[model samples]
Target: MFSVIMYHHINSDDLPLSNSDTMMDAHLAYISDHFTTLFPGDPITPGSICLTFDDAYYDFYHYVFPLLKKYNLKAILAVPSAYILEDTEIAPEQRLSLKHHEIYDGDNYKTYAPFCTYTELREMIQSTHVVIASHSMHHVNLSEDSVDLEQEIFGSKVVLEEKLGYRIESFVLPYGKYNNAAVALAREHYSYVFRIGNALNPSWEGIGGLIYRVKGDGLKTADELFNPFKQMGYWFKTMIKMLKGSR
Candidate 1:
């Protein structure tokens, strides 16, 4: 089965505002011992799990990347092509303090860019431990009719490929919001499309190229993930989402 765990910010100061480094390290350790960690394009088995970090936050470069190296594991780093800068002059702590949407605020881009820079991303990719996926161009909601499906779906693939020098085969719907038009257009451009749903998939094939990811950001510890109750909870949530038919 294919199961994906998604994360966002991993604060350096052990702050749980989103997720702390210590807990993430523990999670990496547990995953290394238990599941066979796979990159996006790799072949999978029953115990396979894909670890994905969304937004390519600075904390990821500072904290989680090292933990990934320590565990010798591979992961996907989802990047919003518009929010990313070539480089940032701000400190990691300062950038980590602001809300993700703050980057769009006037002159905030000059002060501090919240997302990772292309330089940083390139460095991570050099290690062969990371794969980049498009999280859309502006990270906007695709359900809105005013939004441009070409720019949000295919355009992001173009930008990331030009900047990062890699063929981006995956599209992670921003905010997990997408209409059928968005999905249909995405399938036309990319081989894999991802969204938020805590479930297990049989494999990457026969799923119409759509994959579901679980929330790994709110986890408190490795135990919380491995707990039997939590395991059942994931399945139950997945079933509920399946019933609702992906709004």
Candidate 2:
């Protein structure tokens, strides 16, 4: 079974959405010891692990990037196109004040915690260890019918490709909320789509377009995540969710 771990902020601050750099390093070490790290397009195998970061936070560039290089592993970075296009810088104090989810919600996020810059992204991509994928154009919840599907869904792909000069084949659904319409729209654009949830993705079937990922915030330590009993709990939760037809 393969697992896709989801992460948000990787900062030293005590924020609700952040995991300390030390803790992140521990998680990476544990995964390196226990599983083969894989990227978006790589064939999923038993004990395969994929690390994905959401929101394209600057801290990912500040903390996660170097650690990933040190561990000699690859990760998928889900970026909102507007955040990169805006290219604003985040203040130290503001990083402590705002929740990670709030970073994509309002104008304050634009004024406060900045997303990764294009220059930084270029440098990171050159490393050949990072796979850039679309989070959305403005991080809007796509489940709403009033949403501009064409813009948020398709437009973001266009913007990222144009700016990054690469074919973005993967996308992550925002807030882990999606309707049938949203999924259909995403499937039309991306080869793979990721959702926030816990499940063991089996490799018997080729890696499907819709993928489920576990919440990384709940994992405070490597032991908390790697424990076999805890893993069974994750599987049980995923099974219940699937039975409810949620994922």
Candidate 3:
């Protein structure tokens, strides 16, 4: 089956600062040992998987890149371009507001460290093992009606495409939040849109519309790494939970 696994920060701290470096490596190792690592041009549903990182965390550039290089696997990075170079041009008041309120580099405090800088993102892009996509301009949640969803969707795509000089066709919903309007807006601008869930593979509906993604947090455990039965069991549990929640 085809799947897109979502990841965030990659770090060693277990104090729960949103770091996943420890788990990410374990997940990659599992994939390397059991499954054939596939890139963007891969065909799935007959058994193919795609690895994706979200939020453009600095830890990803620092910690995740080395592993990708070692495994020779390409992963998609969904980044917000607006906050990349916050030091320059971004107003001081705005910067302070972001630093104080926004979460950056897995830190919840009032620090001003962007997940990664433009240079770092560019460097990652230079590698054949990485593809950068748009998360959004402000990484704002599309579920909110406060901001025009279309503007958020279209503007972010334009900025990313212009800044990176690459066709930004894929988008990930911030906070895994969205609705029909958000979906329609996204469809207008992006070829694919990923939502957060814990399913094993892309549903037939997901493929026909945009795209769907499942979280890869279980990747931390190395005990039954790459075991099909274990993976299926995990997915089964997750689907059951989702179904229960819906009921």
162-236: candidate 1 lDDT, tens digit per residue: 998988988888888988899999888888788877775556641445688877876777757667786787777
Which has the better TM-score: candidate 1, or candidate 3?
1
Best by lDDT: 1
Better of 1 and 3 by lDDT: 1
Clashes of 1: 0
Best by TM-score: 1
Q: Which wins on lDDT, candidate 1 or candidate 2?
A: 1
Query: Candidate 3: what lDDT?
Result: 0.65
Off by over 4 Å in 1: 12-17, 206-208, 236-247
Candidate 2 lDDT, tens digit per residue, 18-98? 688888889888877778888776877777888889988878887889988998888999998887743545554564465
Worst 10 residues of 1 by lDDT: 11-20
lDDT of 3 at 68: 91
Global lDDT scores for all candidate models: 0.79, 0.78, 0.65
How do all the candidates rank in terms of lDDT, highest first? Answer: 1, 2, 3
Positional deviation of residue 190's Cα in model 3 after best superposition, in angstroms: 1.3
